[model samples]
Target: MDIVVFFVASGCAIASAIAVVAQKNPFVSALALLANLASLAALMLLLEAQFVAAAQIIVYAGAVMVMFLFVIAYVGPRGEIGGGVRKPWLVALSVFAALLIAVEVIVVVFGASLGAVASVDTDYGSPAAIGKALVTDYLLAFEVVSVILFMAAVAGVVFGTGGRPVRLSTEQVLAKEGESAVARRREASRAALDAARDSTTGESAR
Candidate 1:
């Protein structure tokens, strides 16, 4: 049953991965990626890495996929690729990349003599152990990743606004509306006063 489950997850993972690349619609492709992540998490669970599986589901499938979907929605159809004319250089580059991946897969499967999988302890994927490793051994790498993520967020904001700082705030918008209303009221009063003055002069002349 475990073997069957593993195979099923593996197949789903592969199929969803292909669909992620194949789908022209950005939203559909994001859904495919979510499925792929879900299947990968299943595979991780089968390997007895419960914490890793949970993290995979929560982090990649939950947070990352949600972010991707939000971006796709925010960007709308304009963010979709493959809708415009394909460039020759892009096509060539894609073909070359596919061929390179195929070669690497063939070499790994047929040429390389991979060793047996190593065994791990029961707590290998536990949160405590992982946290300890992160703070102790991988502390520098973890901090670096945080900094990179922060920079990425800053860059995203910069590019999202077309390199311009945010100019309008809630207070600014309200102030502008108030000024417009005041100006409109002043104009109305002036018009009313002019009409009253003209009527009084016409009566006096008569």
Candidate 2:
């Protein structure tokens, strides 16, 4: 039963991931990514990592996927050929590296068991233990992650907003306005000088 569940979850994850890459529409790709996250969360559950599974669902499937969807929607609908194959070699290299890493992880963790390994107690997804580790040993890292998340939120707001001049200091705004006025005056002066030169040339010719 565990094997069946694992295979099913793995297949779902792979299928959804492929769909994410294969879909032409940005919205459809985002939805496929959401499906992939949900499938991965279910895979974590099957491994008895309840806390990790919940985190996957809450943090990734819920929050991150929603953000991705929001970005797609805010960016407006793209044409079919929005993103082109500009860097095929780079993409190929990245895919190769990812596959190499996946193979290395499989060999290191489950080479003996033919990729099947039983979950241990120490590896159990206990929320209390996770909390203790996060707050005690990894407190700085946790705080850094929180800061990164905050920055991401701020960036989203900044990028998604329409173009507008942000509020500046009074002195800065005044300086900019004065500079514009000066530029206009200079342009008018140049135009008047050119007209005067043309008129003088015509009178001399006459």
Candidate 3:
């Protein structure tokens, strides 16, 4: 049953991940990413890393996906973006370089004859156990991550406000009104002069 579940979840995750890249619409891609994350969480649950699974679902699939949806809606998929390194060859080269680095890292970490990874405790995946390690062993990294996330949230808020119409100050409003009034007065004066000239010409002709 566990094997069956793992295979199913793994397949779903892989499929969703591919769909995330395949979908042209960013919102649809985000939805695919959400599915991928959920499947990964399910796989984590099967591995007995319950806390990690919960965090994946709550933090990534829930919070991050919601933020992605909001940003996608705000920016809109149809918005035109100009000026970038848009060449297909450049993008393909970048992707290839990234894949190569990833492969190297994976090989170094997993293919090593003598692994440097310490074996975790049986209760490592438990909330209490993970929390203790987070506060004690990985405290600095955890705090740094928290700070980064806070900054990202602030950036998101700023970006969200970018599309909104800014309110004009009272002084700016007054200035605009003054300018329009002056233009209107100039227009009236021009019309009066034209009308008077026509009347004088008519009298002179008589």
> How does each model score on TM-score?
0.69, 0.64, 0.67
- lDDT tens per residue, model 2, 1-206: 98898898899899989998878888888888888888888888877778888998898877888887887776676545576665889989999999999999988876565554665786577898778899999999999999998998899789767697787665675587876776686799999999999999999999
After superposition, candidate 2 runs with Cα above 4 Å error = 86-123, 165-206
Comparison by lDDT, 1 against 2, better one: 1
| Model 3 CA deviation exceeding 4 Å by range | 79-88, 98-122, 158-206
Q: List the residue pairs that clash in candidate 1.
A: none
Candidate 3, 16-37: lDDT as tens digits: 9999876777878889999899
Model 3 lowest lDDT segment of ten: 77-86
Report every candidate's CA lDDT: 0.88, 0.84, 0.86
